[model samples]
Target: MDSNDVRRQWEARSGEYSPEYYAYYGPNDTSDALRCIFEQFLEPNASVLELGCSSGRHLSHLSVHGFENLAGIEVNPDAFDVMAETYPDLAAEGEFYLDAIEDVVTDFDDGEFDAVYSVETLQHLHPDAEWVFDELARITSDLLVTVENEGDVDRDGSTEPDVNYVNDDFPLYYRDWNTIFTDRGLVEVDAREGQRDTIRTFRTAQ
Candidate 1:
């Protein structure tokens, strides 16, 4: 699918997600775990960019934790609209562009951010778009964090796009981070395993 198709898919599912589901103010395990990871890997004043920042939840959470330099790129305008309304402060203080991940290289300078991260994103990218990784590497100066679905499942062998848990018709691609990032000159710094997904962190190889 092309970028337009991707955008429409997300837009179609926007109504199903609300500010509460992506709330940063409340206590939740996902937020708690992310906070811990951020504290560990990201500097307090780090210039952070979230590649697929749906509704700006992570940015809001980062703001609450005193990390001021935060920005995001979200493809879905509806999601961005919700984020802008909910976290006006973030919308005012940081840049949130409605653009696809593959186009980020043109939108930002090389090494524009100290760290770049995405959670429960990336997997939804069109399987053929491996160039997104190169763009990600180009724009990140220090670290990269990705939380994505991995491992074999009942539908593991299929390479076709299908409806996922969120009811979006997007194809999921499980990547081998070790090979992908390492080939792009990033080395694994940390990794944490969860039941169905994994969080992998990487840094530029010195």
Candidate 2:
């Protein structure tokens, strides 16, 4: 499916899914890991851009930390509405665009943000990573931190770990901490693994 199709699909499920479910019960350690990683990269009053920001949980966390000038791209209208209510001021700026990551319009000139962050999001864009990464790097002046799921789950509904309900079209790609930063020209700053997999934070110089 194309970006619009993906956005429509997520829009359908947006009401059914919330930050609480994605954080506590989702297959990823999004809440804890995301908060911890951002604490390191995000500075007070820094401009930030987030891709696939669901329910704006990360934005909420940063707001509490005194970080402003925040923006995000999410395709789910329901989730975007919730974010608008949660962050009325920023939302009014049209900073949060409801479109697929690939379809997000970048009004910011090059090197417009202090940091770019994504958590448990990019893996879903299996075939679209190059485009997403290019956009992220284009807008980010400093860093790009991402948290992706990594493990073995075969095609069948059964596996050694017995984890099923896999979306093979968006299969997870496992990479070491170095791969995200060094190998990909993203400076390897720091990385940590959670209950399931790796959370790698990388940066590129201005």
- The number of the candidate with the highest TM-score is 1
lDDT of 1 by residue, 142-164 (tens): 88888777655454545443435
Query: lDDT by residue for model 2 over 47-103, one digit each (tens)?
Result: 787788776776766665566677887766667566566655546643677777776
The most accurate candidate by lDDT is 1
Show the colliding residue pairs in model 2.
Answer: 181-186
Angstrom error at residue 130, model 1: 1.3
- How far off is residue 14 in model 2, in Å? 3.9
Q: In order, what lDDT does every prediction score? A: 0.73, 0.61
Candidate 2 Cα misplacement greater than 4 A, ranges: 1-5, 15-36, 39-42, 85-94, 105-107, 152-181
